[model samples]
Target: MNLWRRLSGRSRALALTSAGVLVAGGLVTLPVTAAQAATQCSVDYVTNDWPGGFTANLTIKNLGDPLSSWTLGFTFPNSGQKVVNGWSAIWSQSGQNVTAKNESYNGSLASGASTSIGFNGSWTSSNPKPTQFTLNGTVCNGGTPPTTAPPTTAPPTTAPPTTAPPTTAPPTSPPPGQKVDNPYAGAKGYVNPEWKAKAEGEPGGSRVSNNPTAVWLDRIAAINGTPNSSSNGSMGLRDHLDAALAQGAGYIQIVIYNLPGRDCAALASNGELGPNDLNRYKAEYIDPIAAIQGDAKYRNLRIINIIEIDSLPNLVTNTSGQAGGTAMCDTVKANGAYVNGVGYALAKLGALGNVYNYVDAAHHGWIGWDTNLVPTIQIIKQAATASGSTVRNVHGFIVNTANYSALTEPYIKITDQVNGQTVRQSKWIDWNQYVDELTFAQAFRQQAISNGFDSGIGMLIDTSRNGWGGTARPTGPGATTSVDTYVNGGRIDRRIHAGNWCNQSGAGLGERPRANPATGIDAYVWVKPPGESDGSSKEIPNNEGKGFDRMCDPTYTGNGRNGNSMSGALPNAPISGAWFSAQFQELMRNAYPPLS
Candidate 1:
């Protein structure tokens, strides 16, 4: 079977947040592929260790038909093995035998998709690898896959003599606190049905236009509402979390984006909060928000707090193209609101055991520029320090949050833009360099470790719209001269301009929320809800606290900054956080695995 068949059916396998237009919850699923023949997936495992403690990274491929749920089991040869913690699954071990089952947020699998799971373990004397593995009770092929392309010689694993009864235990509902002790076994994700109902109810929306009716329909939802004064200082955030718990959701993913001078480099997304209002940010913003998150009623629900988008990245690399050399972000940073505000929020929110905090590590485009990564490291460290806490208070950091950087840019080539150089084959990255989110994230994670962060700090990438699959992908690595085309089409992402942070065109839902796509990556989350507008492109008067940049103006596509006469603007989309009917249709249509 060929893995690239992008079409459903025996594809080799792997298997595998945010608001509205800002409760679109994180519990997301995608349109399913019709059942295909049973596929025997392959497993790739790696480990990094120090002393007795070690982290195991497993990439579980789905070779069979689409799986709604899955379970993985392996037995260590040595009795000294112990699973200390795990993420993305309900991990449990008995002696040397270990089992990891899918958690609520990540159960579905497309034919070609893969999901990841990881655990930390401690071993005495020697740590031996487990040779036998089974997924969903079916032992993995543990050999090279079969291919239609005739092999010149016999492919590996042609003769299989060994067999074992598949483990009978099926994927089960996670107990109220399955991994409370397992630092990595994480909280269950709660998708807000209210947002799902809203999306489905919208006029001319996805439910009416998308194909296949229903397969993985539950994954799409948005929480675009901001916490302006009318909302009682984040009462919206509180109420949504409450509703999630009411619906039996064990984990709630929340975005705290209303920062002062938000999105400073962009025309759109300027926040309602002022740059100088540190007092209000703390007293009215973080304090009350912390109260609700800290409340005993919500303690049962794991709160994944995504603190402030477009806040820190600006301090280092401001994408806004204000006519002046200085962007408003400079002002925001000067005021110290973005840094201090995030620090205070981290201190308050991280104090909760159930609340896992992820500060923003802007997408590669914004922060991956030359020296900006250093500043990102500095700023994150500053946030942790300002909070009067160590970096350990932060569960991890997130990348591409509310941004449209592709998960991987397979065709990015180094160019001296000032010298007018275009694409070249000098760089052929399989996604472990500066070109894509994956590499940037890996580098950032390593940099964090070097800078005194705990080894366990993980990452989350906002993949809501970075998929850009199928025909949308450019045909050649060095195909086009237009920089955007070169970077977007030839490369992985489809954004017209990296700085154009508004609702980007041709973007689609990326990898579903699975644990540990990469070593440091916790999960690929839809941090920005699909179907919501980045912000209004029309020159509409804004009473709401959101920013109104011409960048949103489909007609105003200047250089992607300052909403100038740049030529690559998307069509006029709806206001930020508003239900964007047409865009919603497009996202579902162009969905990576082909959403319904």
Candidate 2:
């Protein structure tokens, strides 16, 4: 039972009109007229623009009476500008007019409270700001009515000189590793030169070669370079950190893998340590890594450690008595190795002031259901509190790591229905509450906070191989014949089943790594380092302790987790963690947003 499947600010001040009384210093005087007192609000719109596209982040503040729900309406200055997609709200458009309605969870608005919403849009010719906005059918900017004619195109005050706008001002490096809200914010991501060289070696690879990727410390030997080791090459942990300093990078991402009995549900990633190697894992593995990271020399670097992929989720989905439980998972769970290992790792690595530890939360496909969701969070909480580590020791959680779940399914949603049947009833969705990773991650963050994690905690989604773009991507909703037809036809995740997790064919490079791409999301990361194979396509022996899992074999029939479907893995791939040229080429070829 490998649940393997599993997984801008701008301020514009509108002139106050006769409808509302104004005081000096941009404050509104109390006791306004009845009309003005009804629905006073303000909207702050900010945009991060690229050549032909941009992401708009808007913060709407309720300045008047509290409301149970709200609708935000605005218009684009040019007809060429269109809302491609949005999140945190139900977005709709008609010609130049656009509207966003609050989602169920975010509908309540206490007076003076604010909520954030945004969209990614495209533009031609010129992009201009909307001068007027309305909330709940009432004018928002001090009750100014919607203008009948298009406003003049004064150059957007927020637009950047180049296509890609700067996201944050040069951060004053936090005083020698003092913790910050987001390590990636305003910081340059360290690019692995070895990966860059490999990517650049491929034709058309230069397009994405420079993007930042994570460095995996999969084995203890990897902490210090071992001769001829393919994973880290000659670059050990210190070497990579030294190289990052040479490149003047502000931050570096390192995957803290290699717990005893790792990937108990899957064989491809089995670790060198046996099920009872807890003492060795701590003394030989974690202690050394923590010592290195805590060194004063590396304190200025924001070291992000992605702690253990495919570990904890096993306790929920693949443990004893579960539907698809595995013997190995049962043994590991019963012995408490997985929990103790993760907790020990978190406790040790988290003690470093400069290090940001993000425990791995398997993707939505693995634990998105009601039964699996809360238990998975509880296990994470248990681990966070174990071994003297508090919830504060864990800075955040990462989802979709080294897996291919689509970041968002733009064409279809969980709320959609076809022929009177909800999309969740379709074979593709299978009644999962979440239709994609973005929704699940946002929901999971809120759930984690409710479960006693810090409210300030954020989430990271690995966008490494989930683009699901290219000619196969659906342009719109599918035919309304049946729920299955609608979901299958329109869904962007092209896996044979939601449970399939391997070197998937037709996968593509997803959104490029960037900071604070959405609300509650810290960044869209390339944590998996795109070209590495998930596992060998066939039985290949190795000293690294990686066994051949059938899920990585193209010919192998499905397991209970994948509903007995074809593995959907590519052929002739190398062993796990090795570079697969064919897979890399295919990923680049089918990239969504099409690798421009």
Candidate 3:
């Protein structure tokens, strides 16, 4: 996920060659002949060098015709430089000249397509540029955009290894001979059989195909983890826990959703418990889960506890909006349940050594504004204090849970509706001004540390289906009163209303969840597994007993992503946990980074 940039010592940075800009080292450009120049294909070779090691990124552009196969040739200018490890290409070095052939899966280049290969190498005297790139025997010509054709397009790479890495899932339930130090490794998570069953048979169709919306392979079939919800049934949490323990799971991901004033301001997730039922939440809800998790029998298994989602953030929004006006949060504020509940969950659960508690921080769309962030952290701090639990009881914050906020910054940004200038670009960094979840997570880490939490506290992002890239994603801020229209790329998120908070269309799987994707980001997780609906679309409900939210109504389309609209749910979706086959297939087909 880290972009390629230069290192300090004798580094060469590439500038836009259009202005005839020269960098620290000699300019590296590709020359093409007149006939071949029609296409004007280009290649970008970049490197990040350190003292002894360096990284090379090789990008191939198809400005001309799509090719079934292509090979690239480049030579090292430094004599002592040698190749170490590489991905997406087969590399061979003879003297200072090196040749890289495309791998079986990626040789084909689509028109205007570009695929990249990365390698780690060792350098002695200096890391010089690999000048004069040639693709398929034709010399590539480099041009800095805005080119007639875009230079980069990332499609799904290849099928993920069906077998999870040995560190995560082993064949049977007993603890492995060596326990994985980091319980969440290689991004494997539990799957709900019910969702798979819905997709594996009758109405359920292909897990991988190009069938438009008919029945394509969704990543939900591959990378999602089940969240045990209290609304599903009394036994849901216990059953999910039992299954996880039975699998010899190194880590079990649990979502504690039954806050007394659950989803405080939202309708879809309104729990059976009311604002005044703090006792019920602590005694009946928190006590039982804590007892089960803290029990010594399952001491070795790590419990990844995602504390109340949409709970604390609502308090901020509610409290801030009701400033000295009619108090909308009277009941919640009276019982002190929201903050107290999270604290109780943490104190009780943190008493156990294995449970890593991630209290929800909401998504950037909700808390990115400075007005909302201050109170959210204050509530978290008060809650941690009220439980008589120190910051140690909390692990960091989690973002974009069951929400469709953009994962990376820059995918969406806010421009000034008043001024023509971009107001909040992704490049800007502040606690409350982040444009996306990645920056918010990083900012949250700094806040948590400042608020007495450990420096090592890390964040988890629910990438379950936030990968809104490829064709299904929107593209601009063009012709809209909205400030972030350009960042979101025109058409806004397809959710019916901004606050509808139910099943949403046009959402896809985000970056494959991985540990340490960036600093302060603990792991990218599928907290809200795809295929399972966010909430039921219609009142024509099932046995799950979750109340109907009009946001799920397919025809209830509205505009914008904030408080302006209240009914933006997608149509044809099933209840919260039930499989919505169409969404499943759609997610697989439209996955960001493309599902392999």
Query: Candidate 1, residues 259-337: lDDT per residue as tens digits?
Result: 6666666655666666687765655555455545544445457677777776776776553442323457778777777
The lDDT leader among the candidates is: 2
lDDT of 2 by residue, 78-179 (tens): 999998655557789999999999876578999889776666577898777776677988666454333343344644678456667678874332234456
Against the reference, the lDDT scores of all candidates come to 0.59, 0.81, 0.59
Q: Model 3, range 1-596, lDDT digits (tens) per residue?
A: 11112242222323324322223255543332343344346765555455666556556677777889887777788898988645456778889877888766567888888775655577899877865666777555544233244334655689888985677642322321122224465534554444344546533233422111111111111112324432222235546556656765556677777777666554555666767888767655665566455433455566777888777766666653442211435567667888787787776665444567778888776777778776788888888767545575676678888887667644344434324545453222222376567777788778767867666677888886777666756554444444444433443344432344566667776777567778767788777766667776677544333567566666554333333454545577666666677787777666786765
Residue pairs in clash, model 2: 6-366
Q: Mark the 10 consecutive residues where model 2 has the least summed lDDT.
A: 1-10
Off by over 4 Å in 3: 1-183, 186-188, 199-238, 320-328, 409-420, 425-432, 474-485, 488-500, 540-545, 557-563
Write the number of the candidate with greater TM-score, choosing between 2 and 3: 2
Off by over 4 Å in 1: 1-187, 202-235, 319-327, 411-433, 475-489, 560-567
